[model samples]
Target: MKNLTDKEFEQVIFENQLLILKICSIYCESQADKDDLFQEIMINLWKGLRSYRGESKLSTWIYRVGLNTAISGFKKRKRSPFIQTEELPEHSIDPKLQANQNEEVKILYHAISMLKPIDKAIALLYLEERKYDEIAEIIGISEKNVSVRIVRLKKKLEQIITKQLGG
Candidate 1:
């Protein structure tokens, strides 16, 4: 595996920054922690670039690196604080639906925050709409396992959201 040139590295980061940030958000409660995780992920990506054989899609490679860093950092930190909900990126939302959607997003993230580290990584990749095969590759799980986990994760998330909503 060849190392990415500086230009190539910057381009890769430009293309995938949001994906990295989302992974960080899954493992981090505070904005400061998220920022720290993001930086760690970037550093790992730079250091690991030479080893990135093209066995998987580039996005899959990025997911693999991002998730491993997040999970490892989470274990090392052993953070137990509650999720600190952040506002979603600005987008045109119907005024009538904004409040409901915002609350739902917050609840959803809170539910996600309660997940174990691997489950959080799985949930993030699943929510990103990755194909089951791609998710299996990124997570290093069997495709069948990815399918089963998604089903169970959905149920778990539903239960968590319902409990949070007092339903």
Candidate 2:
């Protein structure tokens, strides 16, 4: 694959920015850390673009690269204590539903944060409604493995939420 021209690169990033942000949010707790992770993912995307072989969907390629960068960032930093923040910047939701949605979002993110990095990647893709085959493609796992991991992850998430609620 040839290098992406500046315009093509910009357009690709612009189109998939939300996908990157969602991945960052799943991996990073604080806004600053999220911002840093987002930048790293973009850099990796730019640097890896030439190697993209057009074998997978563009979004799938983005997911693979973005998740790998995030997983590496976590491994390298190994930070135990994250600076807690109120929330990621809010998006416009129906005013009446905002509070309810925000609380649910917080709980979901908290539960996801407890997962191992690779499991977190699986959970994120599952929640995004990606098919098992696609999830496998992104993570380089077999479809069967994706199914097994997702089932285990769902059970684990239930336990986490139950514990959170009980406490």
- lDDT score for residue 73 of model 2: 62
> Residue-pair clashes per candidate, as listed?
0, 0
TM-scores across all candidates?
0.81, 0.80
Name the regions of candidate 1 deviating beyond 4 angstroms: 77-101
List the pairs of residues colliding in candidate 2.
none
Q: Model 1, range 4-93, lDDT digits (tens) per residue? A: 789989899988998997897778876667766777799889998888888888889989988888876555654547544345434422
Model 1 weakest 10-residue run by lDDT: 85-94
Give candidate 2's whole-model lDDT.
0.83
Candidate 1, residue 74: the lDDT equals 52
Q: List the global CA lDDT of all models.
A: 0.83, 0.83
